[model samples]
Target: MSHDAIVLCRLDELVEGQALGFDPLGTGKDSVFALRHGGEVRVYRNSCPHLEVRLEYRKDRFLSVDGSQIICYAHGARFLPDSGLCVYGPCLGQSLSALRWHAEADWLVLEAGQLEACAP
Candidate 1:
């Protein structure tokens, strides 16, 4: 139940119904993005399952117009906001990769050790 965690951001920074991208490794590209949905924060790897490409059309633009679904700009796939499940386009039935995280106080923390284990 103990691990070294890295704070992604203050919870308030994650605006409701909007996507916020994070470059955890300082790679000059976003490795993941977070969204606030139904009073919860959901974090997902930025990659599109169809082609393994980053999903955003531009910085932090992961959701469709009106912010209802996750849109993979590279492949035109649509995913359920809460579940990351691709429901349309080429990768239908495939899901975006979710990262392990939990909110602590006013911050969102990625469970770091597990993330290291999962990193390529």
Candidate 2:
């Protein structure tokens, strides 16, 4: 079977210690986000575990002030960038949904079917 190819962004476009969100499905809201931490790229669903709300306060604003943690502005929950662990806040002991992806040349990508399986 074949699936539509989806490219989130270019590897070089990802600044270390920052998160970039994408709406690959055109859901009008970002469905997932990716960030570079410790020289590796990690991706996770954009929703917070506490209330299923988008994790950013504004576009590409998923990190805390220091860029050390992912912050869900809705409830002030903080998460570890590498593991999506809700280290502090209402969702403590829980984690954001993670997505597995692979990079192709300069693009960070996923197949349409892969994202569809991860969608709600």
C-alpha lDDT of all candidate models, in order? 0.85, 0.87
Which residue pairs clash in candidate 1?
A: none
> What TM-score does each of the candidates earn?
0.90, 0.91
Q: Identify the candidate with maximal lDDT.
A: 2
lDDT by residue (tens digit), candidate 1, 1-120: 345787889989998789999877667888888998887789998888897888998999999888899999887899998999999999989998899898788888997765542343
Model 2 C-alpha lDDT per residue in residues 7-72, reported as the tens digit of each score:
899998889888898998887878899999999999898889997988898999999878899999
Error of 2 at 106 (Å): 1.6
* Model 2's TM-score against the true structure: 0.91
Model 2 has an lDDT value of 0.87
Report the number of clashing residue pairs per model.
Answer: 0, 0
